[model samples]
Target: MNANELTIAEARDALAGGELSAVDLTMACLTAIDAGTPLNAFVHATPEIALDQARAADARRGADAGALNGIPLGIKDLFCTKGVASQAASNILKGFKPEYESTVTSKLFEAGAVMLGKLNMDEFAMGSSNETSCYGDAVNPWKVDDRRLTPGGSSGGSAAAVAADLCLGATGTDTGGSIRQPAAFTGIVGIKPTYGRVSRWGIVAFASSLDQAGPMTKSVRDAAILLGAMAGHDPKDSTSADIPVPDFEAALTGDIRGKKIGIPREYRMDGMPAEIEALWARGREMLADAGAEIVDISLPHTKYALPAYYVIAPAEASSNLARYDGVRYGHRARLGQGDGIVDMYEKTRAEGFGKEVQRRVMIGTYVLSAGFYDAYYNRARKVRALIKRDFDEAFAAGVDAILTPATPSSAFGLGEMAEADPVAMYLNDVFTVTVNLAGLPGISVPVGLDAKGLPLGLQLIGRPWDEAGLLNHAHVLERAAGFVEKPRKWW
Candidate 1:
């Protein structure tokens, strides 16, 4: 198997056993990236820096070092890497490079991981398809036929790279299904650490309350291994929780016996693809066969979740993105002839943000404005409370986790959904947004491929700080599903 096909644990074992060196694995990914460049999954790559890191990891391995000693990683551009352009796939921040590294990036470096390069993502992590990226959309590396597919968004490039074996694992951020949706599209495992469980410092905020950085890899155990290295509290991020980090890598038992999984009735919407429904049934049956009990549960506020997320996330985005004004930082558009100071600011912002970003900022401003605050923003907040309450109730009733389809369908053509009504694209995230709205941890695991052969995925969401439980269940599902071991043509 290719080094990129190996899970993080598998790679670690091989690296420690002297079977593979970080440089060997890094070069393999570089070769894959070169071959897959037609897919445009990565926005930037630093061969020299990557080689240096590989040399460092090899040095550590020779000295008998850490758990993640020779893993090569892809960092989503959303995470700030000191001296690397940390643009969030947006031209607005085109030449910007942070002097400080994101907590996750620094932690992984401490664990002896090699940084391949920054991956592409939605501009400011906004869209459902990577189409919003100024760097260009990442093509889904799956075949829904002989067509271009969207490797879902925000984290799409990260997912696409991992799926194509361009990298062993990649970092991704999820505000509303960003990580898992792309993982589903590209056939990989993506886990969002429980909100606050991972530090947000230098991650480039989207929705401050919901945005989280996690790993996208080949399996649940690999996800766990990567997550363990990246998660921890930091003094820089006050919101980061001080909870004890668990032995996530050691929790991969491949056994979820005596677990109670809940199927939320509200998630089975009318527009769900029949294959998706069948896959859900299959996932549940597989779990039941493993000595688990499946129960139908109600999250009555599910209908309100997407709406709430749209409102709340945009509201926070508006406040966060306001920092990008041309005043002191970011892209500064040229002022029109005879334009005044106000016009300079206007022109700068006009040129900086794309249409969707501008539209969301307008919507955010409108909703937070005096006239619409109570009607839109405040109502969404109240609904958000009920959604969290629903999950709390389900967990209280002995449901270890909630299961749902990661996405309503498998990967679609790159422009298929983008050209149709924009709402069609928004609806794609309907199944996964609720977890973000409720501030719960969730994971997407590759279950099987659809009739068209594009990969489909199953999502498992857990109560706050229940990531270990969620991953344990997913590890079992992953072993049972056994979809890896083969490669498909990139769409």
Candidate 2:
């Protein structure tokens, strides 16, 4: 296998054994990035920074090297990377570079990981498809005939890069279903830890309460390794959890015997594809075979999750994004001769934000408006509380983890839903939005391929801060499924 194709765990072993040099591994990844141009997974390439870090890692190789020493990773564009572009795939922040690194990136660097570049994402993480990106859609390396499919979003580029071996792993942020959905679509492992498990200090905001950063990787083991280096309490972020981060890699015992896995009957939505249903059934059998007891559970509010998420996510996004007015930094529109501050603000936003972003902003503004706030935003918040309560009840009833399909369907072709009703695209997160609403840890494990030969995944939702247990459950499912299929290198 090529050096760039190594998983984080495999690369770490090779680097420690002196069989692989950090410089050589980085060059291999850089070469892959150059060849992966057609996929547009990387919006910004930082080869100089990557090489410098790799060289430093080589100089400091020792028994005490960090877990990620010499590992190469792709940073999501939403992260502030000191001198690298951190636009969050939006035109408003075009050419903008942060003077400091995000807490997540800083932790990774401290653990000796090297940055490949900023990966593309949905503009402000407001869309489910990567086409909303100003850099164009990050195509899935997996294609059917001549049609290109979406890698999923807002962490689409992270999913694509990791799946296609463009990087050992990548950082991804999940608000609704960004990380898990893309991981499912691209047939990789992506985990969104509990809402506050990872710091949001230097990440560009989408929905403050819902957004959480996690790792996208080739396998469940790789996810655990990368997440170990990325997760820790941070004083820089007010919402960051003060709890200790456990040894995630040590938790993968592969013994899930006697664990209780809940299968929510509410997840069986009407009009769902037969293939997705079959995949879910197979996932249940796999876990049962591994000695996990499958029990039927009820989350009655599941039907309302999508509406509540659309409302709450946009509401928070509107408030968080208010800082991007043409004032402080980033893109500012050139005003006409007699134009005032208000004109510049309006013009700048209109010109900078893409259609999808503008649409969400408007929806958010409407929901939060004085006349409708109580009817929409407040109502949505109430529903969100109920959704959380549903999960709490399930856990309180002794459920170890909840299992559900990661997405409603496998990846659809690019532009397939662009002209359709926007609500159609939002439906993609039906199974996932509930996890974010509950502020719990969740992971997507590839379980099987659809009739079309596209990959499908099963989601395992765990109790708050129980990523270790959740990962183990997913590891069991991964082992049982043995999903070793990779996207044919059409790009």
Candidate 3:
């Protein structure tokens, strides 16, 4: 197996047995990244710094070895590191370097994992195709024709790096479907924990309520391990959940027998690719073969989820991004003499934000304006509550998890969906967004490949703070599907 492609569990066992050193693993991944530069998977890399951290991990192995003692990992550019660029994949923050580190990255450092530098992402974590990155978009490794496949965004670089073995695991943020959708596109595993489960301090804010940091890896066990390393309460973030963090690595027993999994009938939408529907059906059969009972259920708020999510997320984004007025931080406009403060704000924002981000902020401000607050924002909040209630009811009804297709279709070629109305792009997240609106944990695991040979994914959503259950179930399905093998590299 490729070194960066090893599962966390697999890597840990080998490391403990003295079969691999952190330096060796780090070098292997670095070599892979060097080879994959044409794929545009990494925006920046710190080879010397990464090796130094790896050597430190190797030195601590016998004395204070933790689960990730010798692991090499990637940090998304969204998080602030003390001396790293920490640019949120936007030109606005090009020279912004924080004096502090993000809670998740700090935790990963504390976990003895070697940091392999920052990965690329959609500018401000805003796009679905990753083409919105200030850096170039990441290419999917599995396209039969070697044409560009969106390794989906805003975590596209993380997913592409992990899928192509550029990183063992990369951190990702999910506001809507940033983590899970990209994971699906790249045929990797990604989980977005319940809102507030991971600390947000020092992560460049997109949407306060929706932004969450999680792991992108090649397997269920790696997801659990990375989650264990990244999740916990942080005094810096008031919203960080104070609940005791479970050892997610210990929960992967691979025995999901007798568990009742719900197959939400409402998720099968019109125009869903036939291959994806078949993949979802095959997922149910795999869970059943593993002794799980599959039951049909309805999340009646399904229709409202995407609309509600779009409203709330963009609203929060507008408020959160208001801080970058171009004076105290971010790219300030070079104003001529007599330029007023209001004009400075306008020019700065105009130069900084991309078209999609500007459009979203405009929609957000308008919705929150007195004329439409009640009609749009308030209603979306009510629908968001109903979405949560729907998930709560299903879990209360004894469904261990909800199974659905992670994406409605396999990754499309670059520019294939360019002329698409933004609504069409937003609908790409239809199946995954509801899970975020409900603030429930969900994971995407590779289930099968399309006839075109691109990977397809099945999503498993669990109740609030139920990451352990989600990971175990994904491993169960992952084993049954046998979709964890390496992809053929085009370059």
Clashes of each: 0, 0, 0
Q: How far is candidate 2 from the true structure (C-alpha RMSD, Å)?
A: 0.7
- For each candidate, what is the lDDT? 0.87, 0.94, 0.87
Q: Positional deviation of 187 in candidate 3, in angstroms?
A: 0.9
Error of 1 at 322 (Å): 0.5
Angstrom error of the Cα, residue 285, model 3: value is 0.8
- TM per candidate: 0.97, 0.99, 0.98
- Among these predictions, the greatest lDDT belongs to 2
Output the TM-score of candidate 3: 0.98
lDDT of 3 by residue, 439-467 (tens): 88989999888898788889999988888
lDDT of 1 by residue, 324-436 (tens): 87877568888768988788778887888887788788888888999899999999999999999999999999999888999988888878877678778888789888888
Off by over 4 Å in 1: 62-64, 485-487
